[model samples]
Target: MTRTNLSDIISCLSGYDPDAMSVTQARQVINDFVPPLATFEKLAIRSALDRVLAQDIVSGINVPANDNSAMDGYALRGDDLPASGERTLPVVATIHAGQHYAHNVSAGTCVRIMTGAVMPDGCDTVIPQELTHAATDGAVTIPAGAVKTGDNRRRAGEDLRTGQTALRRGKILRPADIGMLASLGVAEVAVQRRLRVAFFSTGDELRSVGEVLTPGCVYDSNRYTLYGMLKRLGCEMLDMGVINDDPAALEAAFRRAAEDADAVITSGGVSVGAADYTKQIMQQLGDMSFWKIGMRPGRPMAFGRIASGDKEAYLFGLPGNPVAVMISFYFIVRDALLHMMGAEQAPLPRLQVVSRSAIRKRPGRTEYQRGILSADDDGIWRVRLTGEQGSGILRSMSDANCIVVLNDDQGNVASGDLVQVVLFDGLV
Candidate 1:
């Protein structure tokens, strides 16, 4: 498929300004630029957990297959019920689950039925066993108004009808979905191939684990965090170790990543700095854009598609600070990757809760403050900041259970004020 030029996409967005792009605008650009992968692979339902469906699953037969009893009771015609007194009906037959009663149930006669047992030919209702009293002469007594027609009877195709779409395309299959597919007698299904993401960290002052930490160098923690996040999203990852601050090395890394994966994510060198060579390399390689986004902690970001000879890949250049990298990724890159994987993407829900402390903020920029959410004595949900809010403070991200989102127009938040927050439970 032919990809739309990044410039063309940008030109179409009204008031599109890279220098002062809002979080919403940046997300829209990425959404419009990334396209879902068309390639798909068929896999057994047992192995298809968390995979996006490539095709709709049409049911071949009705679920339950026949009109069945939903309760262990006596099945009889609804008209046989008494107007104001008890009615006794002779028990003609007993049917268990997986059994079919072929004889018609005549008026004043009932069949003892177990759950999942097919209803008798003339039975249209079932009075639950608990509501019926047994008689000595092989009969059961049902009280007036005990049940109405169709009460405890499950109609055929109630769950899924023949030729109906049981599951739609772009669904991320879960355990329940697997069970549903099994109920439909589907052994295998077509799902979109996993998204390939190549990520790396860049800095001369960065060292991998097991390496001796020099005076000015720090151990690289970004790659490990990136790995955790991408793994949770079920992406196939390529972790290219820390690249040095050199033009040639940066260019080679970008080319290799673009050629090898469907998308490339780099941690450093996007921000304005003398030693930052990643931005230059990205611009030289593809249609990249460097922007100072209107968000705190992660203001500087780069996004575009980079090419490596015949192969091309989308690029996301995040900030060097640890906290900034995570915030940028979760807010910016996560949805784009899901789209590329052909999965249905929904916005992460932001819950409104009261803040327990005063927060410093401004009106023009958005801020994502790490916060701990808890229930008060009154069982009301509340959030408090995780001490200092610094872009480089990785510990803040760990201690917090949610991120308090302050919109661009929102200013300082006072104690007891309500704010919007996104939880990190399934996300982080």
Candidate 2:
């Protein structure tokens, strides 16, 4: 498939400015540039969970396939029901589940049917066993107001009719979806292949875990967090460990990641610091945009498409701060990756809840403050900021259950004021 050029995508957006981009503008650019993968594979239903459907699943048979009893009851003709008093009928035969009575049930006689048993011909009503009394004489008595026509009977195709769509394309299959497919007698389904995502962190001061901690060096946590987020999204990840700030190493990492995966995500080296070689290397290999977004914790970001030889992949250069990396991924990269995988994704809901404390804020930029959401005594949901909202404080993110989103035009917030928050549970 022909790929859309990044330059053309950016040019089409009104008021596009990379240096002073807003969070909404950056998101729109990524959404417009990314395209869904067309490649798909057929897999057994057991292996298709969480995978996007490639085609609609159409049912060839009715769900029930026949009119059957919904409960253990006496199947009788509705016309024989008496107007005021109880009526007794002879029990001609008994039918268990999966059994079919071929002969018609005559008036004044009924069949003792178990749940799921096919109703006898000419019987349209079923009086539940508890509503009827059975005698030693092989007869049952039903009260006048017990049941009407079509009671306790499941009709054919009530759940799904022939040639009806059981599931639509682009749906992410869940456990219930798998059960539905099984009910239609489908053993295999066509699903889009898992998205391949390559991610890494860059900084000379970052070290891997289990290594000796030298002076001015810290262990990398962004990669671990990125892995967890990507795993939850069902993407196959290639974790390229920490890369030094050298220009040669940065260029090689970008090229290799682009060649190997459908998308590349890197934390660090997108800011305007002198040692930030990632921006230069990315610009040289592809049509990249470096932005100073009007957002807190994650203001510096790089987004574009890069190519290596005949392969090309989308690249997202996030900030080095631990908390910023997470906020960027959740707000910007998550939905774009889902779209590329051909999954139908609904926007995460932002709920407005009362604030538990006053918050200092400035206009002209968005801020994502890590928050703890809880219920008050009256069962009203409220939010409070995690202490020490620093970008490098990864613990704040761990303690937070939601993100308090302050819009670009919003200012300081007073206690008891309503604030918009997106729950972490919903994003994952």
Candidate 3:
């Protein structure tokens, strides 16, 4: 519906079960309604912990930069070794790491070197000190032994070379990648700006968690839950706090949340209910779509945009139930947020796990049954159900280490069956 027609709030956001919209269909709608935000900024290297690389990082110098010893050894020209007996090679000069070489190996000569020391020039092999006999002077005798032409020597640029792509755009830098960049002597990196997100909860009956339990009022948790997950992704967030279920208050909160955020996310008020003002107010001022995606515990989720001049800030309305929020974040918003950040599109990891019990489910909705993964003695991962799959029971979500992903077309899963398990460790 157009913004003009949306001015009149819909008393009922469709009765369509979240399963009515397929994941593909929902993603398409999200793409059509919410476009990516404009790019901005020169972020500091240390500040870009999880941000996507906006530009390709190239090495200015080779990793290792020069040939160095992989172990403590004697640098010698293999061909210069004597045919028999102890070949006395004068220890010409020592070459240690981080120091320039003043002497190169001459014929019948070698040097005592430590691991990481520059391989002396004109030396083709390294005889680890343990393999050789000691001498009185700064010299060692080499006994006849097997020696490869260039063993134990790490060549310059062997790991990476100057002008080679060290890191690509859209790659989320891991700890190893960070060290690799540092090895290239890169103290700074160009990365996409951290997405600024805003979050809030809406319900007149909800009270702050620390406050005393009042009659008919439950503790507010959506704001903190969303905040925690987003924080783990390195998001810059603004907590909009809680706006009571009143329409005017909801409208003011929505306006403020969209004011400085790339996205504004809420936990409730988009379902087929009369009092869900978050949906009503969103319809009035922005072009937002409320979809009941075909997914369990997360069917009431919505995705769209806030009209901001010629642009629209993205919006994701999560379900009120705790488990539904987790599911929506994993199956929906996470990818879109990654795309928005310019990170390369990597498919979410999926695993084949053995089910410990039968799961009752329907064909239309994809169910994410919370479960604990057990590793057998053979080291294979198997999944077992966590008691009662109620979406509102936050404890089950907390104790769960993985989710058994039941396909949309499949229903009940019997015990001893192989199923897909999406791990909570970020790997799967």
Candidate 4:
């Protein structure tokens, strides 16, 4: 790609109103950029769970290793049954889960079997133990109509045929995937390594966690917040702690971040503030596209990267406000992380819910309002905003289970109006 001037970036990002980029614009910018190529690491299946698969997995063996019984029952040849319901069949033998029978089930004969025991040769039906009455005299009188041929029989290779592709590449493994692999006797899997993420916070008034909070200083949140969010995305994180507003310190942090991480995430000190050193560092050190997005609580967001030799690393400067960081991540960086891990175009969870109260908004900018959703008396889910929309109110975010999203083209939404909701679980 050629060099993109600041004016071109701004004009291209003006799809949202208020001369600011929206979440859609932010996503388009990255989706249009060159994504970092991912690598794979062979880890144990336990570790590979929830990670995207680097290659497709084919079945190594039949799903069922052998033809076995589907129930704790008696295996017999039903074709030899008498016309009447009474059929006195002498017990030819007994078959447990492991031991093999000495002989095949003969005509007018049956073998006592347990669930999961391989069916003896010549036995085509299984009569459940509860349906048959047996005497200790080596005689089991099974009703003629108790079970038919092929009843309670599990056929081998029914679920998955050998050499078939069970799971495709780029698909994230889940619990069921684990079970499927286990059925094929696969004890390990090859998965992409966790994305390496470097994160820190920059502000003159910020302090580290567990430290005493001063009158004007607050405990740094961006590091912990981004750490947790990245953890959920299966990323390996290197926390740089808190970087001050000093230009030298910020530059040094960038040098380390460029060397160690595939992506660097920072919060605060990106806006047009006197104490902000990020802008100065970006201008001097590397090419970065910084802009204000047209969304509540997250207007001051930046996405860019620096080139070192033939290699490059991403940089994201999020607004310092706690809520802004969270909202911006959901709309901007989550999909990028997913793409880096070889996931298919990851999309946010968009849900539809009714409005419980009137929500006012201008018709030019998409807004995300932290909301609590509940089903009303009519069994309809309704969503409404939390008390305040300020970026400093962490409690509002904690109290909300989802964000009620309103598009830029939509205006005020009255009660009973339908709105789309994006759940928080998807963000993490």
* Global lDDT scores for all candidate models: 0.93, 0.92, 0.77, 0.81
> For every model in order, what is the number of clashing pairs?
0, 0, 4, 0
Q: Give the higher-TM-score candidate: 2 or 3.
A: 2
**What does the lDDT read for residue 407 in candidate 1?**
94
Query: Which lDDT tens digits does candidate 3 get at residues 1-428?
Result: 34432212322334433447777666655544444445756665666667778889988998888898887878888796656676767887777778767666788788888888888778878888887787545888788754566888899999999899989988888888887877887778878788888888777778877878789988887777788888877778999887888988887777777777888888878787778877878878676667777888788876667764454467899888877887888778877777776678876788898887888888987888889999999887778888988888888888889888898999788988889988889732
For candidate 2, write residues 1-428 as lDDT tens digits. Answer: 67678889888888888888999899899998888889999999999999999999999999989898998888989998878889889999999997888899998898899999988898998889998875434898888888887799999998899999999999999999999999999999999999999999999999999989999999999999999999999999999999999999988999999999999999999988889888889999998888989999899999999999999999999999999999999988999999999999788899999999999999999999999999999999999999999999999999999999999999999999999999989475
Tens-place lDDT per residue, model 4, 242-282, is 99889999988888888888888888887889889888886
Error of 3 at 267 (Å): 0.9
lDDT tens readout by residue for model 1, 32-120: 99899999999999999999999999999999799999998888998898887898889998999988877888887988899999988
Q: Which residue pairs does candidate 1 place in steric collision?
A: none
Q: Would you estimate the TM-scores of all the predictions?
A: 0.97, 0.94, 0.88, 0.85
Find the 10 residues in a row with the least total lDDT in model 4. Answer: 10-19
Candidate 2 residue-wise lDDT at 74: 87
Q: Note each model's CA RMSD in angstroms.
A: 1.4, 2.0, 4.5, 3.7
Sort the candidates on TM-score, descending order. Answer: 1, 2, 3, 4
